[model samples]
Target: MKKAVFLDRDGVLNEVLTERVKFVNRPDDLYLLEGAAEAVAELTKAGFDVFIVTNQGGVGLGFMKERDLKKIHGRLEELILEKGGAIREAAYCPHKPKAGCECRKPNPGMLLDLARRHDIDLSASVMAGDHERDIEAGKKAGCKTVFIGEGETSADAKAPSLQAAVKDILQLLAD
Candidate 1:
């Protein structure tokens, strides 16, 4: 079985549009956070299958077209690969927060599907995100969780940022 690392997209892989307090609806709005590419590369090089599990409710809300979302993801993948990182797959839920979607954060549907598709060992995998919902999803999916940021969380571990989180996860894998 393969070990995997699931990551949240917005605050984890890229900067959230805090200025607008909304999602990155346009491809131009997408921006990779500092050190995110390098951190992902390190994890890939360490033999963990890397995947992105995110909630993009903006689509369901009609704020953005699906093609625009694809463009953003394309740019993201290009940037990561250019930086020597590999993303095994990306999964997202387009349902509104109140739509009761199974694949949204705080729900394990996406992670569970990824595990099944990739033959992943949930026990050996890790989920890293910046929100409580991310941790909740990982916990429910039976994977170790790493919270990337401060404040109270139920994650198994916490790191100041994605770069630091990857470092800690690698250390745990070594142990």
Candidate 2:
């Protein structure tokens, strides 16, 4: 089975905006957080297939469109490739908070789908993000979870930044 890394796109990949800004409707708005590219590069070099799992309810809420999301993701892909890393796939839940969709974080649906499609061994994998929901999803999916940010979580690990997480995870993976 293949091991993979699941990442959250917004606060974990880019600076979490103080206020949501139209859901990053254009490629121009898809910015990378400091060290994000390099952190991802490290993970890629460590031999893990990377995937992005994001909650994009803004699209469902009519704040953004699918085409807009595509454009933003396209730029994100370009940037990752430029930094010597690549994401194998990206999946998002476009349902609003009240929509009760299954793919949103804090739920294991998305990870389970990826596991079924990619022959993933969740026990050997890791999920990293800036929120508790991300860790919760990882837990439900049976993977090690890394939480990044202020709140204390029952996550397997915690770090201050994606870069720091990368450093520690690489060492752990090495072992």
Model 1: CA > 4 A from native? 20-22
Candidate 1: pairs in clash: none
| Candidate number of the best TM-score | 1
TM-score of each: 0.95, 0.93
* Tens digits of lDDT, candidate 1, 1-175: 8888999999998988577435688777888888999999999988888999999898999998888888888889889999999888889898888899789989999999999998998888899999999999999999888999899999888998899888778865555
The per-model lDDT (C-alpha) reads: 0.89, 0.84
Clashes of 1: 0
Residue 149 deviation, candidate 2, in Å? 1.5
Provide the global lDDT of candidate 1 against the true structure: 0.89
> Model 2: per-residue lDDT, tens digit, 80-110?
8899998888888888967877798889888
